[model samples]
Target chain A: MTQTPVTDSAVNPQVAAAPVAVDVPMMRLHVKILRFNPETDKKAHWVTYDMEAQPGDRMVDVLNEIKWYKETGLAFRRSCQHGICGSDAMLINGRNRLACKTLVRDVAKDGGTVTVEPIRGLKVEKDLLVDMEPFFDAYRAIMPYFIHPTPFPAKEQYQSEANAEKMAHSSNCILCACCTTSCPIFWVNGSYIGPAALVQAHRFIFDTRDEAKQQRLGVVNQNTGVWRCRTAYNCTEACPRGIPITQLIEEVKREVMFGQS
Target chain B: MYKGREGQWAFLLHRISGLAILVYLLLHVFSIGSMIFGEPFYMKIHNTYDFVLFRLGLVAVVAAVVYHAFNGLRIILMDFTSIGVSVQRQAWYGVLGITALATLYALIKLIPRIAGGY
Candidate 1:
């Protein structure tokens, strides 16, 4: 057998140790979620879940993973998986945001936990889904659908460039209800027409094709309508679509006050 | 007139009465500034106070001012901290109760003075 010479340095007791080959497992995310079931329970509870999330994983992905692999009873509302759907809005770390657009890595960047709760100012139906009937009711009460004058063909209504530009900004409402849910006025007075409905009313009031501007203005002129807004600008901040809700509401108030529309 | 929603009704009433009080304040300031002209102008305007309608107008202005002041304080408190939002309904009721009592006291005192019996 051939003898292999071992170096004295390799066998030395005081030699600097080679870098520790410790296999550190990737960090896991601890999501503290609020859960409620009014049909069966009297109070809400917090449920925790450990999710292994990658750098680019979104909140929707983590939720879907939990729903599919961990707990079949977990429930949430999601659609389109894009920012346009506005269905996945929930409170992430005490702020309302669309779950489909929030990156998990950014939220859990410091290797800390994240908390998810249902949007405030609405009745919670399940884990993360809120009953949006009140929100949509306010939207419909404002007459969101277009109402143009009669005696016109089925073709597109002719609108000048200036007219189109006037109504363009208010036309970006996606009916997300995020702004409505985030508004303090709506939380206090459910009868208040809210920012979403007021913005919708402004949309029609500014549109050149709409001939019922006066009637719409009359509808919003009631005590619970545009007057209820205190211009706190919370709705504008909570809007994920970046719609200028406060500006539109202010313009509508100006028009109503001056009787210009 | 709104029955079921007392809090909302109170808010609307507060705003309406606040605006009324503001308008009345502006008019009162303008009328009082007429004193700069001399006692003749002051007496001319002050003599109108002896009439019944003018007395009633004084009462209305007083009531509106009292209610608006109390409600404005409540709103200011609401803006100062989140504590007011949590107890907003209670705070509103407190303002309403205080305003009603103050208005009643003022009316009692004013009616006697107007009748020249105080």
Candidate 2:
């Protein structure tokens, strides 16, 4: 690679002439988003916006462009712009994904048309934000915490590598609601505890030290529990964290059917 | 639809086939149960089933039953074993292949009946 020597004018603060960099390619994207305001609109509708965006931009970036300069009234949630916060999950191009994780180049076509919608099986509160209380309520019902009959060790409870490995895969759940909302069963029956809850339950249920395994099993063994999973595998495909949700749910189902070995 | 993959298609076909089998079962029960009323009534229903279209529909019902039975076993394997879960997508294709072959075999056997209108 050849380096160009910088002139004094380029480095001087008071310089009037300096070369500007505009070599980056920007593609025009047509974003169609679902819009609804309870206080204003009587029903939900879709609105499209055409704007210039980089092909490498994330879906969240395009939404940011629309919210920042195009339409300020747009409502959505995003705390950590990355995928870890478990927020900003939405239906992007007919699949559940984190806006922060999905890139424009992946979903956009030659014409650059992308459709965004709120995750299903929940009340859409605004344009992209849905009521998360029901999702959280299900997670709570699963008792997504460690419990042991004996008192804690003075330093820390010992867990073998093998024991930790059993629950390690299920521990990746960020509670993003991606898996739960993508479920076809949950779409029809809201009472179903859903995949996210099962993932959470699996996280603790498999723990060797958790004494509440039986109680937790009783909670998920209900009619609205693991049995509702029709094995559509949509949750597995939609999961941004790539957790084997269907497999874990199957394990939980087995545990419920024949007592854990 | 969220553009689900093979598992989604499998679940969908399973549901459809199960329903198709149920419909066939109900029709079969009603037609066969007519024997209690009289031989003529039973014969009349049986004769109606001999129509070319009904015979062709029977082939579809058989296909549905075959697909449902095999897919039910696949689902059972998936529920009980990790190997089944790993190979579910492949097993789905296998189920389709088996259903197609079974349907073809049924069609070949029934071709004489369907053509002769017996």
Candidate 3:
């Protein structure tokens, strides 16, 4: 493998003027990727690969490299290479992280093993791909959209900045299921409304513009609803968007406990 | 491997221990209620707590109470104060340590009593 200085982005020409005149250093990263096939394998197995890489490559890029040169059977989900898409969220090392966002260098700047696996609590359809229907089911149950009690105004209705800021952080959620799937509560009990759905519920619930507050509250207060959450904080740590998910759940719970007082 | 976070384990223990304690409380209340009969009849009741296994169960109940109470305090402090989420793991370790020490002291005091008599 060639370790040519990866000037993939040559915008900063000043970089080329550095006359150190040395071969680009090589990094060997041992990637232990979990593999499973429903048709054949009875259980999942770890497939570790020792490969050369640039320090700047993201974990997704490493997967791509493996798929490009080594294994054709590897599978995962990604669309936007940026963090916004939230498709490539997986258990990196131990915690959930978007493969597209986690730089390999950040994982191991000195080059070491990085384990990759599908997020827990979801059925793995193939390799890294998991059935997202369960996650979406919870999302759909929350009616993840704006609601209005009255007829539409002819013009836009204004909302105060403070009111808008209440739903601000939760509104940034990408529905990646990272926060929800990482939760131990949701992991063991699929009936529980997971963090992502609650976050989505929270997004519309606190919206001053939305008129379905009571309906939303009723839905989340069910037996398999927000009450199941134990404030574990896993969702907050796992969110790629860095939303304070446990706090949002708490806010909704508070609203439920003492309505509009 | 799924290496669980500290909060997850603590929450699990809190729930399990809470359930066990509830069971113990209900049974104790039932036994006390059974004392409404005559004194001789009440004295004829089984000495369940006199057994070694019963003593062990009591120790477990004591341990659970210690852990749940201390962890509850840790959680309360975090809620009321500006304590950041970063120290959560350390806080868990500290509370667990205190729980262990307290449980050990309770066992030391209770063991001799059980050995002596009913």
Question: In candidate 3, which residue pairs clash?
Answer: none
Q: Which candidate should be chosen as best, given TM-score against the real structure?
A: 2
lDDT (tens digit, per residue) of candidate 1 on A20-132 = 22342344788889988778778889999877666566788778767755677877888887888789888887667788888886678646798888887888888888889
**What tier of docking accuracy does candidate 3 attain?**
acceptable
**DockQ value for model 1:** 0.04
Q: Write the per-residue lDDT of candidate 2 for residues A46-135, one digit (tens) a residue.
A: 999986666667898788767755688999998798899989999999999999999888998646789999999999999999999999
lDDT of 1 by residue, B14-103 (tens): 768978878877878877998999989887877766787767666677777777787777666554444554465677788778877877
Q: lDDT scores for all predictions?
A: 0.74, 0.88, 0.80
Q: What is the C-alpha RMSD of each candidate to the true structure, in Å?
A: 16.5, 5.7, 5.6
Measured on C-alpha atoms, candidate 3 has an lDDT of 0.80
**Is 1 or 2 the stronger prediction by DockQ?**
2
Instruction: Rank the candidate models, highest DockQ first.
Output: 2, 3, 1
Q: List the residue pairs that clash in candidate 2.
A: none
Candidate 1: Cα lDDT at A54: 62
Model 2 misplaced stretches (Cα beyond 4 Å): A1-22, B50-52
Cα shift from native, residue B71, model 3 (Å):
3.5
Q: How well does each candidate superpose onto the true structure, as a TM-score?
A: 0.62, 0.91, 0.81
Worst 10 residues of 3 chain B by lDDT: B77-86
- Ten contiguous residues with the weakest lDDT in model 1 chain A: A1-10
lDDT of 2 by residue, B84-106 (tens): 99999999999999999999999
